[model samples]
Every structure is written in C-alpha cells, then in structure tokens.
Target: MNIEPTILDAVNKWLTPAFDAKTQEEVNELMTTAPKELEDSFYKDLEFGTGGMRGVMGVGDNRINKYTLGKNTQGLSNYLHEVFPNQEIKVVIAYDCRHNSDTLAKIVADVFSANGIKVYLFSELRPTPELSFALKHLKCQCGIVLTASHNPPEYNGYKVYWQDGGQIVPPEDAAIINAIEKLNYDQIKFAAQDNLIEYINTEIDNAFIKSSIENASFNTPQSAKDELEIVFTSLHGTSIKSIPAVLETAGYKNVHIVPEQAEPNGDFPTVKSPNPEEPEALTMALALAEKTNADIVVGTDPDCDRLGVAVRNNDGKMILLNGNQTMVLMTSFLLKEWKKAGKLNGKQFVGSTIVSTPMIMELASSYGVECKVGLTGFKWIAKMIKDFPELEFIGGGEESFGFMVGDAVRDKDAVAATLLICEVAAQAKAKGSSVYQELQQLYVENGFYKEYLVSLTKKGMEGLQEINQMMVDLRENPMKEINGQRVIMVEDYQSSTALNLLTQEVSDLTFPKSNVLIYYTEDGSKICARPSGTEPKIKFYISVNAAIENVSEITEAEAFLDQKIASIISEMQLK
Candidate 1:
C-alpha cells in the first residue's frame, strides 16, 4: 500500500533510535499493510480534557501509549517548571491495576525527573483518590495518576492534579494544555536516569489508611457492631487490597468479600464495565449479599475512587440506589450521626454538584449547615473547600457514585467512603434502622428528590455533528411545555443566560460558561442537557421532587417518579 506522506513520516520517526524498537516494528507493519489505520491512529494527538488524557491503548499520536504519555508528562513538567521556577517542584504519581500501568507510571516518573522535578511515585497500584490526597499531604506542586478509571479494558488515562490536590482547572488547565500542544515528535524526553525518580511504597499506604480510619464515622456505641454484616466488592479493579484493610481497621468485623471478583485485572473479568453505578456491574455482589443475609453491598471501580452500594430495603429485596439516592442517604446519615456525637458545629458544611439531588441542599439547610453546589466535578467541590477556609467540610458527593468525606483528600475516596458507610450501617443498627430505613427517614424529613440520568452515545464525526445539530435545534426552537407540564424558566449555560419564559425576562447566569441547557417546569421538575466532555455522548439529567407523608408510600412515589421520567423522555424523544 502506498501510504500518505504525513503518515509515512510519522512511521519513520517512530523507527528512530529515540523510540523503542518494538513500537517501531508495530508502526512499520501498520504503515506497510494498514496505511489507513495508521493514518487514523497518528493523524492527531490525544487531547487532555477537563479531567485529563483518556483514549484507546496503542502506539500512535491519537492513542494512549508510552510515547504519548511521555509527551503529556513532559508538557506538564515544563508547565510546572514555569509555574514554580526558582522553587522546588514536586509531584506525586500513582497508577491503577491496568495493563502497562506500572510501566506508564515509571515512564511518567522518568519524565518528571528528567525535567528536574521531584516525583513521589507509588510503589504499587493505588486508587485515583489516593494520588489526590497524596498531592495535598505531600505538598506536591502537581500530581498524575495513570488510570482509565471506569473506562473499558483497552482504555487508559492520565489525570493531572494541582497543588490543591484536585484535578487541574482554569488558567492552569489551559496552560498545561498549551504546553502539551507545543510538543513535536523529537522534543519529548523519554530517557531513564535511575536516581532522578523515586518509588514510594507502604509508608504512604499506611499513612493513607490511617487517615481513612481517623476520618471514618465511628461514633456508634461499641455494642452495635455485631449486628452489621456488610458485603463489599471491588469489581475486579484496584480496591481489592485497600477496601478490606480500611474496613477491618475501622473496627467493623464480619465483612464478607465476593471471592469470585476479588482479583484486580484490567479486563474487569466479571463485569461488563467496572462502573459500580450500573446495577449490572453489581449483580454478583448483590447475589452474594442476599445469600449472606447482608445489610448492604458496596463496590468500587477499577481505580477505587467511585463507589456504588446496594441495600436490602424494608421489603428484603436488594435495590440499587442511584447516585443521587446514595449521596442523600449517606449525607443524611452522616449529618445525623455527627449531630448525635455533638460534632455538628456551626461551621460544618456539605458540598454537591449542581445536578445532584436537591434533597442534599434541603437536608443541609434543615440541619443549619450550608450546602454548596459546584459546576459538575469533584475538583470544583475541592476548590470550594479551599475557597471557604472558615467552613468545616462535613462531606461532598456527585451523582456518579463518587463521594468524599472529610478534607483528608481533595477528591473522592472510595476507601474512605466504604469505611464511613459501614460505620453508618453500624450506627443505624443501634437505632434499629437499616441503611434502607434511614433513607426512608430522610425522605420523611426532606422532600422526595427523584433523579434520572439518560446518556446517548453518538460516535465518529458524523455522530458529533448530529449531536451538535440536536443542541442547535433545541436552542432555536425553545420548548414551552414538556410532557403536559409548562416550562417556567430556561437556562442556557453555554450562553451564560437564563430566560424567564413566563415573564419574558432575561438575565445573565453567574456560573462559568458551559455547554449545558437546563429547564425548570412549573411542577418542580428540572431537566438538564449536557454533552459529554470526554466521550461521544450527550447526557440528560432529570430531577423531580414531591412531598412524602409516610415511608410506606415510597413504592408509589417511586412508581410515580418513574412514570414522570418516562413521559419526559418520550416527549423529548431522547431514546
């Protein structure tokens, strides 16, 4: 095959002495026989999004491999040098249990070392949140973790963090991207110099676990522990090692592990995807929970940052609580316990995303603690914590099954979440209330906040264009009513404007500009439309709330909420 000139040049460059021989042969084979695929692979560089770099694993400009990972690291290191020139620059690097993760971590360490930055590299696999916490605890200038998180087996990612221990945001994010964009084929440094890089091991691990236990909710009277039998799963990701240790160290006994899914593998052998938010991913754990007469089932993703739990409701059937429900349940339980222990000072507050369950806000307000809403990411929540130094952060969560308690880490920590949930379960046992019963009590106090998240994947260039067209159509012809409900207000975040459609008034939105549109109906229904930043998908978030007079009506309320969601989806043709 006659390859394109540009692709041929890229292949030749890969064959250079600076590049690995194995990578060179792979590129050569693709160039000689699969010219089209080669071009597609090397046509453009992988992008660093609002989070960080994520893509398919392969050797090319557009994929996640040693060379590309090196480039991203070099750029980040250069930016760190520029940002902290004349001062010591340090960074923490961690990786998950994915294929080549250890190698990638080593490569990143080499790049940081080559650039005159001190690197605190994890000696073994760790969760994404640990890296975030390490950034803060170690006082590093920046941090990186080689993890694809909940992505498919063939995918891997690199997340960049700032000194605040949150993922990089704003001017720094743009600056890092600018640095990454300037690299050419020959500019990235990939050579390894042994002394420049340092590998961190159990010292940090013990410290992190100690911190997890210190931050755990252990206020329950010691007598309550015997009644709690909790089942936990790691979903064949990174939590197989740490979650159990944290639970045992937190004084919770009788914890059962799902033996079938106990091992950590990048393929995520037992589940379709490592994401615990999906009920399908928790099938094995749920079954084990039922067999053991367990009170709850908790699972973490590959990187062990996000967590999902399935609880046996009053009906004795296992029901998976959505992300919103989980946060509401956890937050309400934590706050109640904190108050009981006399820890609810006036300065304590909670954080959640703008699209998370409104019940959190109501719960916080009723407790006389402020509830702050970030744009949509945990990093923003971390930023809020940094912004308000006077406020003591109780806990914060996103609806994606990610929650963080305590300020020990600036990001979500499933290990911390797991320990706390078990403690909460034990506390509930003392009160003769299961976690499910606590959820019902929360609804009795706060209004019922039902949420639905619908994601539509649109792949390739044409699919992206189609998604854009749908957004444009919606903007051009605004809807006045949906599913027989009148829309009272419309908020277009991309334009930073909110329209009072009823009064024909317009006002500027205070938040940063984003490609999101939100509609509020007269009947307390809220709908949000946002295009996914990292993937080929658009997500619709629906939140509907109503008063609940009694816990027995939860089933009818849930059914009513489901029907409402169905009508909205049908009216919007979102399927």
Candidate 2:
C-alpha cells in the first residue's frame, strides 16, 4: 500500500516511545497486515466536535484511545486554568458501560489531576445525566463523561460539560477544540496525582434521585402509580439502577426489569445497536412486556441520556412511539399538569429542536407558555435555559428520544423522563384512559402531527466527500417543489438566512450557524436536512400535519402523512 506522506508522519508519531508498548505493537500489526485500516486511522486527528469527540476505538490519531483522551483532558485543563486562574479547578467524571470506558475515565481523571485540578470521579459506571447533575451539585467548574451514546460496540466518546450542567457549546466548544489542536503527544501528562482524585458514588445517587423525584412529582395519584405495570430495559448500560430506583421512589410498585439487559455490558450483546430509537433494540423489552401484560415498555440508550417507549394501543397490541410522539406526550403532559397545579405562569417555557414536530409549539401556545426552538442537540436546549435565567424552564426535548424534565440536569435525562412517563401512564389509567389514548386526544386537541427521520450512513473518506457533495448540491439548487407542493420558504442555517419564495424576502436567523437546511411547503409540510455531528450519517427529518376534528381520524391522517413523506422522499431522490 502506498501511504501518503501525511498519513505516514502520523503513523510514525505513534510508533515513537511517547506511546505505550501495546499501542505501538497494534500499530505495527496494522501496518503489516491491514494497511488500509492504518491509513484510515492515521489519516487525520480525531475531530473534537461541538459535544467533544467520538470515534472508533483503536491505536491511531483518528481513533479514540488513551492518548487522544489524555490530550483532550489536558487541553480542557489548560482552558479551565485560563478561565479561572486563581480558583482551585474541580471537575467530575463519569463513564458508561462501553468498552474501555472505565479505563478511559480513569485516564481522563488522571490527566486532570496531573494538571492540579481536583477530580470527583464516579466509583462505577453511571448515566450521562448524573455526570451533568454532579457537575453542578458539586459546584465543579467542568465535567467529562466517557461513553458514546448509543454508538456501536467498537465506538466510545468523550463529552465535556460546563458548570452550567450542559455540554460545551459555542465559544467554549471552539476554545476547547483550539486548545486540543495545539497539544502534541509529548505534551500530554499521563501520570496521576492520586491525592487530587476522589472517588464518589452513593452520595451523588441519593441527591440525584431526590432531585429527580421532586422535579417530576405532580401529585400523581398513588393508586395510579401502584396499578401501572412498567417494563424497563437499560439496553446494557448505566441506567440499570437509577431508572428503577427513581420509579420505585416515585411510588411505582409494578415495575419489571428485562433481566437480560439489566446488567451493564459494554458489548451490548442483546441488541444490534444499543440505541433505543431503533425498534429492534426494544424487542426484548417488548417481549417481556407482553408476557407480563405490562402497561408500558421503556428503554434507554447506552448512556441513559435518551429514552424510547412502547405503549399498548386501543387494539391491545404493543406499538413503539417515535421520538416526536414521546416528546409530544411528555411536553403536553407537563404543561397540563403544571396548569392544573397552578404552576403555569407567563414566565414558564419549554423548548424543542427545529427538527421536532411543530405541535409542541402549538401546545405551548395553547397553554400560554413560550416554546423555543433550538438547532438540534439537547445542548442547545440547555443553552436556552442558561440564556434565559429569569424565565422558568419547564421542560425541553429533541426528536431523538431525549427529554429533560425541569432544570435538575441541563442535559437530556432518561431517568427523569422514564419516571415522568410512567407517571403520565399512571394518571391516564386513573382517568380511565391509556397512554395511547391520551396521545390521540393530544392530536385531537392540537392538530395531528406526524414526523419521520431517514438517516443515510456515509462511512470512510469517500463517503464523507459524498455527504458534503450532497449538501452542496442541495444548497446550490434549492428545490422549488416537493410532493407536488410548492416550496414556500427555505431556511439555510449555515447561511443564517430564511427566504420566502412568494415575496422573495430574506430574513436573518438568530440561531447559531450550522450545516442544516429546512424547506417549508405551502400545504404545511416541513423537511429538514442536516449531517449528524456525532455520527457518520446525514439525516432528513420530515414532518406533515393536518387538523383532526375527531380522534378516530388519526389512523387516516397518519396514513396520508406517511404517503406524503414517501412522495417527498421519492421526489428528492433520497431513496
């Protein structure tokens, strides 16, 4: 294999004495046996995206390894020092059930300790949200979590969070990236300062559980909680203890666990992918739910930051609800409960992503609450919470099965979401209704909205180019129509501009610049295109809605919307 000079230089750097012996041996083996793999791994440094870095675990510059994590921690340490020069810097660290996650978490803590930063490291694996909560609870300047949320087994990630209990965003993200890029392998401090590292566990768990219960409690009837049968699966990750604990503490008595997936296993042997958004991942839990005649089936991703649920429909058949459906349920339920409890003042608000269904905004409007739209990730939602400290952040969610209740933890949290979702189910049951029935009622109250997401995975160097070309083509030649409907407006997030086709007037977008495009149709259809920041894929989110005068018409409306989405996909040649 003919290696490029740049790739060879990177490969040679790993072979030097600065790297460990095992990493050196792995690199040598790859050079001799798998030159293509070596090239792919050494071609470039692992990019630190807005939420930090995620990549395949291996022994190369582009891979997530001890060295890469070390360098990132050191850079973060430097930035913390620069920002808070006189104060004694402190950071909390957590890991999930991913391969080498525990080891990597230790390495991260070591590097931070070496930089003279006090480290509060979890004694065992925990959910990602707990890390965010610990950061703020402990009053630490920053925090880190080592787990690639729902990625494949071979992948792992490092996420950095600010004191605000949200993932790093904007100026801080750029600054951290710059600091990471300036460091060399030799500059990373690998030695640990044991005295500065403190192991913490039970104390934080108690506080987090207390906070979750307090935030989610809406005086849910105890009889309803007792009658609700909940089947929960952690998907072989960190939510094993916390999710069940929160439910039980909230007075839920009939909760069952999927035994096969209850334990933390990095391989995620039970599912193809640990992502709860995928239907297949919830198969085991669904089966268990059927056996137990459970009222609802819930599953969380590997990091416990996202949640997916399946509820029994009117036909007594279990059906999985998509991200939008769950968000609608949670948002609408929270708003209603708050109003019922006399908590809905003009100062309360909620948030969702641009790709999420517009029904949330309508629901918020009906309740006289403000609904803010962010770019995509939950970090943007958290940023909105931070930006508007005067207003009460009721709750927020994205179309990725991620929802956060209240402000206990700024990031998307499955623990609180799972508990609150069960509460919603309980109350519905008490009212002689089911979760699915309540969802249909929601559609009847606030026009039916159906959302679908299609992701095209583009792997390796060539695939990256193809993805970029696709975006360029869309931007250069905007579509005038889709599914025979005229494109009334086009919003280019990268350019921070929105164009109204009829009036040909352009308006500036206030959100941060991102590589995303949204097309609005004259018939109330919306399409969003954006590349995943954390994965090797481009995603298209389609949402179509119609007024539902009767709850019985939901099926017909859903079918019509599905066909509309299909036609749009076909017209755009996305198939």
Q: TM-score for every candidate vs. truth?
A: 0.95, 0.99
lDDT of 2: 0.92
**Which pairs of residues collide in candidate 2?**
none
Best by lDDT: 2
Residue 564 Cα positional deviation in candidate 1, in Å, after optimal superposition = 0.7
Worst 10 residues of 2 by lDDT: 44-53
Worst 10 residues of 1 by lDDT: 216-225
* Superposed model 1: Cα runs more than 4 Å off: 1-21, 31-44, 341-346
